[model samples]
Target: MILYGGNVVKKAALWYILIICLRVSAKNGVTQDQVSSRTNTLFDDVDDTQKQLDNEVRERLAQPKTVWVIHIPTRFPVLQLEDLSVTEPTFINTALVRSRREYQLGNPELEDPIISNNTTPCENVEEESSSEEGNVCDSDRTESEKPSEPEKCEEQEEKPGDDWTFDTQHKWHENFPDCAGQSQSPVDLPIAGLIKTRGARKLLFVNYNEIPNNLTLIYNGRNVILTGNWPRDRTPAVYGGAAHSRRYLFHSLVVYWPSEHTIATLHYPMETQALHVSAEYGSFEEAVANSPKDPLAFLGVVNIYKFDSETQAGLRTIINSAQKCKKWSVSMKPMPLSVFSPPFKEYVCYQGSLPIPPCTESVLWMIRRRSLTVNRESSLAFHSMLLGDDPPQKVFIRVAQALNDRHIYFFR
Candidate 1:
């Protein structure tokens, strides 16, 4: 409407060709619902930038609820694989699991929790014993959630001379009825019917001259021990002998062979004895279970008598340490506790029991009122050293028992 400068320049090139034919009819007159509304506004601006990057990755893996404690030491039939997991969704296959196998506890619909200790723990939760192992727990578990059983591991402590031996030990009163009571033992001493006591005394031999660098020997499967290690104030004791008025201590020597207290009617082929104990009790089964009716134990004997002459050097080092015990134990070597305490200028005392087994009658024995010759090649090498492991018949005087109403003192 204002083209006046003329025909000016031909009306400005005819109004620039009518303004490019009206923008080519407004770009070919676009339509089809404005190109489907600009292609859904460019996919709604990429779904609002993927919802702001999934809210900044779920606010950095959010996790706050404070309070989660744990301590672990556990033992015994248990399986806790903590938080066991597997929220499987195999592309929506939907498989949620939490297992631990045996002694289980992963209740994903439970059925495996019988925590037993000899039975009684029914807790079938839902059904997950790898898919209900024959599920069976609907007894309405009530006995107050039962779970108190776990005490069965403390047994070994018997030894009443472990079933007796000293050769059939006269059927050890059939499992030791104190070997048939009536106060049993190697009895039969009667050195000319002793009994001349002044309540006898004069035996105390403390530390019998120390002497003990080794000593063990042992056999206890019956006879032959030796013992003695010392210290605890140089051990070795023996209290005023005859009838040891408690002090005891000293402890081992035993032996036996062909003799076991038999002086008068003579049988000494070898003996030895010596034990002791009760130094205010601390063993010997706490001094015979706290001195039952007194005499906490003593014994002393010596016996011997083979004589062809010359094997005595402490009986050839205790018959060469009992030829290294056929099987039990050995270690010997040391010697002098007064070469096995043999100086008793006379002693015979008695009160019997315990030549072996529960033969316990709380002994006090004594005996060394003379009789120790040894030799005949050390009693035929101590009776041919347990013939390689003897024990099958031929038992020589099986420790001479029977002498009932015991009495024999003599301590002159």
Candidate 2:
């Protein structure tokens, strides 16, 4: 019994020592409360430091890199959707060149810099800087702040127009040598056929007419239905619209084919005022061409009165099928073609003077033809200009020329 009691007491002592050892091993000479408090303080400090670091990063990013920008003088600066890229940031750099010498961005030897912060006339600078000041400026300006009715007053005030000529220090043309004396017109042009020409050139229209021909003993395996007539003297057949020097004559003919394969011609630029006639029959083979600089080179099918993909696809499929067919008839109209429905294709009658310098008589016009089926809804949402809802409208076709009693032709 005594031995059993001794063993019990020894076990209890060993257990108490183990408990003390465990407690000592768990902490570095600190109480549980003290350790917890210190840990909380360290965590709070880390959190506050992290927040401050995050704020600093944000502030640095928010700051704008200020640079002085100038506009270089140009006769016509055409702005197109192609000029802007969603993936690219536009940073335009302007340089000032003089007859004496060309100066770049930095040259520190001079006392007064070329562009000073005070002289840099960026209109939005003040607003942006004030915004950067943030809540501090808001608090300071509280007493001085006045409720602004900008929306009400905006309509009444006349905003300054964006003048292209503004801040132009030295006009290049004014100082440069005049080349007007070197300009002269050519009497007769060299004829070209069956060869391609290169370099920048202008095409002035001479004449355009459609002449019908039957599917004769086939030429080059394809049925040649219409032959375009370019007069011997590639000038306008009839000049004026009146009897004395006004009334003009034009050849207008309709082509008939079996109902299967319809024919339609697409005039590109849709706005070419003048016809550039090459001595050659085909445009592609003509060496001296008068078409658009970069004419849409790809082949696309055109219906008489509308732009139909199904009809195009059907025709393409038929052509691919290699079937020997005898009969097909296609229809065409005299005036503007009419083969489209509402919304998808709209027809608006416009009466405007001819785009040419002479300003010929107005004609009845119908424009909408193609019902372009977009692949996705996101494709249509490109209207946002990085500003607001006022998306710009694109002009697919040029303004129609004034019809001066001229009969236009089509394939039926």
Candidate 3:
């Protein structure tokens, strides 16, 4: 048995941590009135501290809630069940980054900074300075506080990353000089007076009807890239339109909102650039490397579309899969080529570069003369996917580049 005077409780009762299974009771000789009087002041301090914390929580919960608020580590209003085994104390720490029992507690050397805060799967977390005063982590300080709210989803997006960015396309010449080249892409295809060519065969699309077993969809910060597994001999290929002789095989496709290659001044709802590289090249990189002057190296098939009253199954599959893609690449079930390469009786062909930066001016663009129609849900799905029920961001598209007297041709 241990005996301590009422003086000890008054000085640092809250500061001391008591072990479980240890019984703390009134002193054997001390009367009930003496114990109550001695501990009254200490209880008052604890009441004041706890009341302040409880009120703060209520006030915030009363505030209006957004559609979806992403928080770092975990959600706000963290609910924990009371543990009976522990001895009573004035405070408890519920905001630890890693739980000693659950996560093996200690962080490894040079741990990932993202998970360093708390190993909670972060979602839409604003990520303000962790050093803010009165954070909930300061539970022992006699004050209570909440974690920071997330910032706008747009703010969370990376700007001017190490590689090129869609945000800074105008200043791209500072990094990739080709972006400013004379024959840059995404120019206005004025269909009225384009040069006409007749009886062009070999607009052949081999293996387009067959779905590839291996496919991937990548969200690379700016745009989504869809890749298909092209078998060597039976790879999807396009021939004859602008390619005088060489066969162009499937490379990759990039998704864009507000069509890149506009028909006159009209900007359609969506456009997909299906990039194809010459079969002669061993790899897509080789084709890109030789693209500066080789027109036969790349072929860009442009599909422009808008919202219709009804949705197509292929289009719906893409939209659903895209929402799940999130930030990185995801393996996808095979989608038919019809979603990308709609049948075209006539196409307008032109010479230009890849639409975005490292804008190599070496593509033969085959654009369908008529626009296609798709469901509007694709647009809404992407908006929610990117911003969580928020309206979509304004079109951050590269305005049509100057044609610079380049000839636009019509092939039938």
Candidate 4:
């Protein structure tokens, strides 16, 4: 006999009972051939019943039924109903509703078997209904009551100091595509490719000898920046060494601790970037806004933390001042230019761009090979300083960019 209009679970339970009966019969002295024949007969009966149910479903779907809804329990939440004649069929597209309750066809008299969150299906479904009686499949709830699309939890915004940092957020290619350009900064200096040559030309430091007693130090959320009013006439400047007789004016000094990748590549504990802009440009802002071909230079100095020797007085002054200031705070005191001055005159000259945002190209980079030493205690203090209200970023370093066709010129 064929079972008609029964739940899938009931069919499954029946199949389970038949298997147990066969096993019990076999234990009661039934021969192996007899058991196998009985099992085959049971499977044939199941297949014939399934074929009849499938045909009935097809015939029911083909008819001009007033309402059609199918519910199938599967691994994923899938609405199995198709050919749903509704005003807004767009919303019926495979909605991934995550729920534990089962769904079933609803009664045609009360309402259409619309998608809902009810625990039970329609208890009194009629065999037939009229379309004029408002038998339409749709969401039972109002448009406003429906749940919105689930937000992607995996793609959370990169919080500061979490997955992003001052140097990391402004990534080379991901965040900032300009970083992938031909002229990018902080490139790995391989000893084999360096062109050792005589001193290209000495960079004249005007008024850099005079040490200012008090200077302004500010934590700009990203780095410890030293701010000062540049004198219009006596502003310290550097000329020569690819400057093409043009002078580059001093902008500001930024301090940072080497990131893990930077330490592995450069073997430096600390790094200081002395930014400079062409004298032709009235200000640093103008230089940055100008074309990428503008003559902007950065003198990068690497520093090593030392416990055996005396701590650098310049680093100590900044570290002590930072201890007093909060994130994004500034302090004005005597900060001599000599404190940030490059200790070694020898440097590796290369054409590169800024390590930070707007990674403008056509920059003259002077990386000093010789590293200065700072107090270990003071160097460690940098980890405690926070960038703005962000969590403490122990190191601020950019990943090394591709060298491409750039050449490194060493001048002693």
Best by lDDT: 3
Every model's TM-score:
0.23, 0.17, 0.58, 0.53
lDDT of 3 by residue, 243-263 (tens): 655688887877777678765
Better of 2 and 4 by lDDT: 4
Q: Which segments of candidate 3 are over 4 A away from where they belong?
A: 1-162, 324-326, 386-396
The positional error of residue 157 in candidate 4, measured at the CA in angstroms, is: 22
lDDT of 3: 0.58
Error of 4 at 240 (Å): 2.0
lDDT of 4 by residue, 1-412 (tens): 2355457769889999999999888775543344445334566668879999999999988988467678752111222322222232233122232131111111212242112233122111111221111111112435553322222212113234233455454454675577678768777654333455443455455655443443566664456777566556766677765444667777777777752113113434566677777777786667777745443434333333322133344555556566433444444444345555533445556677777776777577766443344545666676566443455533466667777887666554
Q: Write the per-residue lDDT of candidate 2 for residues 268-363, one digit (tens) a residue.
A: 111101122222234422321322231211111122211111222111111222222222222211110110111111111122221111122221
Q: Where's the lowest-lDDT run of ten residues in candidate 4?
A: 129-138
Local distance difference test scores for all models: 0.52, 0.23, 0.58, 0.51
Model 1: lowest-lDDT 10 consecutive positions: 92-101
